[model samples]
Target: MLTCDHPFPLDQYDDRVKEHLRFTGFYHASQIGIVQCQKALVNALVERWHPNTHTFHLPIGECAVTLEDMAMILGLPTDGLPVTGITMSNFETLEAECLHQFEIAPRKSNYRGSGIKLTWLRDLKERLQLTDENNIQSIGQYSWGSACLAHLYRALCRASRFDCKEIDDPLTLLLVWAWIRLPYLAPVPREPRSFPLANM
Candidate 1:
């Protein structure tokens, strides 16, 4: 299975930076500490997943992760419009957008097709003044919850195919939801439950 191994950087940031992340709707997500991906459980769920219907076909009944789960488990805002946008297919368009939003135009080499390198993004994030009201406002307007849930759905759909071997989605959110809803399949949470259930 594909692993989500990134660290939580919110703890490392100063209060000012944390406030900026909060304003941009990433504060709760950033607060989630990394948890081991439950591979066996995830794989079993994948096998039961019906991409056509977007639900798990368990013996009990059909169920799917709802937007409410995203809001409660991940603390994502689910009331906004669906996250949708046109692709920036060319380097020039991508560069211009980056310059406009991030105020730093990465070199063409830093981009692979339409996506920029994570390393480059990390570097830019460090260099940019996140406290700047303009930058915070630019990012805060999007429906981050919808964007996250959409990507997770897309990843689950792709991984449900017989030809696919690995999942590249937010497994933490999925696992937490499963644990809360299906206690029999869950390990005892080492910590007490918290606001974002995933943090427990």
Candidate 2:
């Protein structure tokens, strides 16, 4: 399974930045601790995934993660502008966006095709300041929950392919959703679920 290990240091931010995060619907998501993925369970679930229907084919019935699950599990906004944009664009545009969003210019070495390394993102989180208040706050206008669900669906579709050997994406959301809905397949939560269900 492919995993993403970039953890945000939310506590390092000041109250102002923290408030911005809450305002942008990311505070609860940022609170989620590292989840212990059960690879066997995940593999089993993937085997049941139906890319055509975007649902799991279980003996009981078909079920799938929805926008509501994204909101409940990750505290991301479910309603707003869709998270759609030009992904593969000119390097100059990409550089401009990076500078606008994180206020740091990335070197060409940071490029991975059209995107920069996750390390750059992690570095920005460590040093991000709300210098451009409106610009940063504008991100709160997008439906991040929808974006997450879309990404998960796309990842599932690709991973379910016959020759696909590994799954890549944030598996935490999927695992948590499964844990909540399919208890028999879940690990016992280390503690009670907090505000965002992923915090369990």
Which has the greatest TM-score? 2
lDDT of each: 0.79, 0.80
Q: After superposing candidate 1, which stretches have Cα over 4 Å from the reference?
A: 1-11, 89-93, 107-114
lDDT string for model 1 (1-200, tens) is 54343444444888887887788787888888776778888887887889888899999999999888998888877765466878888899989988887878989789976788777988887776655578567677777777777787888898887787778657778888889889998888787888788878
Evaluated at residue 164, the lDDT of candidate 2 is: 78
Cα RMSD for predicted model 2: 2.6
Tens-place lDDT per residue, model 2, 67-122, is: 88899998899999988987756679988987776667888988877778877777
Model 2 residue runs over 4 Å out of place are: 1-11, 89-93, 99-105
Number of the top lDDT candidate? 2
List CA RMSD, all candidates.
2.6, 2.6
> How well does model 2 score by local distance difference test?
0.80
